[model samples]
Target: MKITVVGAGAIGGFLACKLFAAGHDISVIARGATLHVIREQGLRLHTGNDLVIAPLRATSEPKELGIQDVVIFAVKAPALPAAVDAAKALIGQQTLVIPALNGLPWWYFLKSNSALSGTRLKAVDPDGMIERSVPTDAIIGCVVFPSCRVESPGVVRHMSGSKIVFGEPGGGSSSRISEVADVFLRAGFDAHAHENIREEIWLKLLGNACFNPVSLLVSCATDEMIDDPNLNTLFVEMMSELLELGNRLGISPKIDPLQRIAITRKLGKVKTSMLQDVEGHKHVEIEAILGALISVADLAGAPMARTRTVYALARMRAKTLGLLPE
Candidate 1:
């Protein structure tokens, strides 16, 4: 399969390297230092005790790569709009687009059979540019569970977790979903083709909606946040509000707030991706992680007073740090 991974950041670099190693033709859409590094020394991955290098095609222009069999979007939420715009030329009629992103995707409500079907999430796709550019039939919902970080411009360090779930946007089985899962499985990931990918997305968002923004507010790691009594209470309240909103949308996650928190606590002193972005002076995913949830809550008529409060504070913090527009 010919694959092109956008961003060439943490998740993008990791997947590109693994897929390339598995004998798939791989290319990357990147810019600035990342593009230069990959072109000069190839994309690198640090997993376990081995450092593997996969020399593949690397370019900033999507048209240069032409149409790909599969295009994986691994960019951060804030960069997604521009990334999608730039990568439009990479999607052919038979192309499969898998967005391995955190938080709510722009296509979440596109084919969703719930009352909110066709509702556009302004938090992620404020201008509907992504919706107009990418075809709905080409999208395969994906939830990535791996924790990875960019060790350098062209290098990605795999920390832990390898589970990647794929499913059709409208739910049910499909050959495309299974094909994508098989591709990941060949690369040594714990990949699955789920019947309901939205449920898996909501389950992951249960932790992201709470941990990511709060970590930005408090400057604490996962274990530290879970250990603090006051913050722990806040997490429970925010998560409960999200639970109600999900239920209203007909998404009933198997785990509760406490169980989810416990699972995160077991991950030890893990720094969330939002915190990493803040510390690195990069843009955090405030809109996608928190703002999107609040939008759904409003649509579902669920009160998210506590979550709204945290979101406002976190948004202000990001703006203050120059990570967001004023």
Candidate 2:
């Protein structure tokens, strides 16, 4: 399969290297030092215990690569609009666009079976740019679980999980989902197809919604925040609102919020992606991870008082640090 990874960050690097090693024609779109390093030295991925270096084609401009069979949209939320615009070069008639992003995606309610049907999340995809650029029919909802980080400019470290769940948004268990899963399976990871991708999305969002903001606000690890009585209560309250909202949205999450929080608390010293963004002084995913949820709550006519308070604090922290626009 011909694949183009858009972000070329930790998860993108991992996917590119692994898929390249598995005999897929992998093209990565990157910028700055990361692009330079990948072009010069290929991609170095350290799975903690093992290491693999796979040569791949790297370019900043997507037009340089031409069309691909699949374009993995692994970019951050803030970069989605630009990424979608650039990704047009790689989208052909049969091209599949897989978005491996976090939180509530732009197409969450399109054709969904919910009262919030036809809702558009401006927090994630403001101004309908993504919907305009990437049509809903070409989209395959992807839920990624690879815990990776950029060890250096061109190198990535795969920390824990290496699984991804994907499905068609309109509830058809199509061959495309299995095709993508086969790619990942051949690359030596757990990949599965789902009928209800929204459930998986919300299941992942439940943990990220609470833990991510708390980490950014307190600058503490997941276990530390989970161990704190005050933080635990705060997180549970936030989860309660999410659960209620999910109920209203017709997505009865398989795992309840408290059980999910308990499972996360046991992970011990794991730093969330949000905390990493804060420490690196990069633009955090505050709006996508937190603000979007608040928007969902408001749209669902659900109460999110606790999440609102946390969003205010987290957004304020980002604003104070100048990571967010005032």
Candidate 3:
């Protein structure tokens, strides 16, 4: 399958390298240092003791890369508008545009049948910019369950887990989803097509909404935040709020908080992607991780006071540090 992965960050690099290694025609839409490094040094991925390189064709201009069978949008939430605009050239009529992103995807409730179906989240989309940019029929939402980071430009390091759940917005299995899952499974991923991908997304977001903001506010690593009494209390409160919101929407991943915490603690001192953005003076994904949930909580009539408070604190910190727009 010919595929293009937008954003050369950790998740993008990881999936691009692996898919290329599996003999798929891989292209990357990247800019700046990342484009240079991938062309010169190749896209390198470090998995445990092994370091693999991908001889991929990468260019900053999307027009250079023609229509593809699949286009994975793995960019952070803030870059979606511009990213989708650039990726417009890759979307053929039958092209599958999989959004393997963080938090709540902008396309979550676009054509969904949930209680919140067709609801556009302004916190993330901001006046439906992304909605108008990407076609709704082509989107297949993905839940990425991995912890990886870009160790440096053109290099991605996988820390733990490698499962990606794919599902259509209308729910249940489809031929396209099965085909996509087969492609990913061949690329050496624990990939599967879920009947209800939204639940999986919520499960992933539960930890992110809690851990990412707590990491940002306290300036602590994942394990450190889980260990601190006051921060841990905040963590629980934020997670509780997210779960309640998910439940009210009739979508909750079947996982206990203790199990989720155990999974996070296993990573041990890992800096969340948001925390890393804060440290590196880049824009953090406050909207996708926290703001979107708050917006939905209001629509769903779920009590998300704690989540809102956390979102406000984190957003303020990002603004004060000049990491986010005022």
Q: What TM-score do all the candidates reach, one by one?
A: 0.98, 0.97, 0.97
Which candidate wins on lDDT? 1
Sorted by lDDT (best first), the order is 1, 3, 2
lDDT of each: 0.91, 0.86, 0.87
The TM-score obtained by model 3 is: 0.97
Candidate no. 1 TM-score: 0.98
Question: Per-residue lDDT of 1-326 in model 2, one digit per residue for the tens?
Answer: 88999988888888888898899999999999999998899889998688898788999999999989999988878788889998898998899999989888889888786677888888887888888888788899989876788878889988778779989987669888998888789889899999999988998888999999889888998888988999888888888888888888788877766799877766567888888888878888889898888888887787788889889999999888878832
For model 1, the local distance difference test gives 0.91
Candidate 3 lDDT over 1-326, as tens digits, reads: 88999988999999999999999999999899999999999999999898889979999999898999999998988888889988898998888899988888888887778788888888888888778777889988798888888888899998888899999877888998898888999999999999888888889988998999878888888988888887777767777777777778888778777777778888787889999898878889998888888888888888778888888888998889898843
